[model samples]
Target: MSRLKLALFALIFLAACRTVPPPAQPHSGFTAEQQAVLRQIGFQPKGDQWEFGIADRFLFATDESRLMAAQKDSLAHTATALVNVGIVSARVEGHTDNTGTARHNEKLSLERAAAVADALAQGGMQRNRLIVRGLGFRFPVESNATPEGRRENRRVVIIVTPEAVA
Candidate 1:
């Protein structure tokens, strides 16, 4: 009986001596500020990406890499939002319609992407955080046969990942 009691006491003591780990912190998808910025910028979550349609004023003219004043202002807001959300990295994809030659389209796309990257950098986003890709006439969201579709295809897409968020 004494041996049994000793064994029980030993087990109890060992259990008591075991260390308890700290509780894990709760994780929300995004910060309030980030959410607010997303809302302000009118971006909707689409699958794994956030999609933002460039307003008419921000739309790039054909074969042009220059940004309008309003476009710059809009990009500045986007940059501020990205900074607020603690995005560590992002890909800026530039796409062009099939109107021009493939080589011309590719060059134009690259130039447009670079222009956006420059604008974002000017808006205070770290240049290192931005990756520029020019898709040319590839990866069209709509059929390039129609004018409207071509217009929709000529766009810049900013891709962000969950791992990118701090």
Candidate 2:
């Protein structure tokens, strides 16, 4: 075959072998690092907006009014990007310090998830694409025996699943 024809044949063969990237793998669930984020958020997602609380976890609490502060902007961006790429649905889980009663922790976790979800929304995600849940003291990253452990236990976690995006 002529050089040009040979080149064309090779190109066609390569193109035929190239398949659409397999539909992205379904999200298996949260990773260890992401679970660490839950330790930071202090809650977990059971479904949509409901939040459960974990007493023995440490979570960072910030104001909803300033939810988009630079510190969390990168996370917001990443989560949004994943959603935009049709890779996953965003999950915001919240938790709280064990400084309060079980009821209080539950409520606090829900608030924290809502706060993060709000930040994500501000970053351009549709509200329907967000799932928020709070787990109060039901799941602990560390034992709540000591003050430090308690501090570590209060947190919120974000879990993204690919199935949502598909």
- The candidate scoring highest on lDDT is 1
Residue 61, model 1: Cα distance from true site in angstroms: 1.8
Evaluate residue 22 in candidate 1 and report its C-alpha lDDT on the 0 to 100 scale: 92
Q: What number of clashing residue pairs does each candidate have, in the order they appear?
A: 0, 34
Which candidate leads in TM-score? Answer: 1
lDDT of each: 0.74, 0.60
TM-score (all chains, Cα) for each model: 0.72, 0.56
The sequence of per-residue lDDT tens digits that candidate 2 reaches over residues 1-166 is 5999999999999999988787876443655555444435443545432133544222564222124366367556655554454534566777655666789778877887777777766667766777788887787777777877766665666655434632
Candidate no. 2 TM-score: 0.56
Error of 1 at 108 (Å): 0.9
In model 2, how large is the Cα lDDT of residue 120? 67
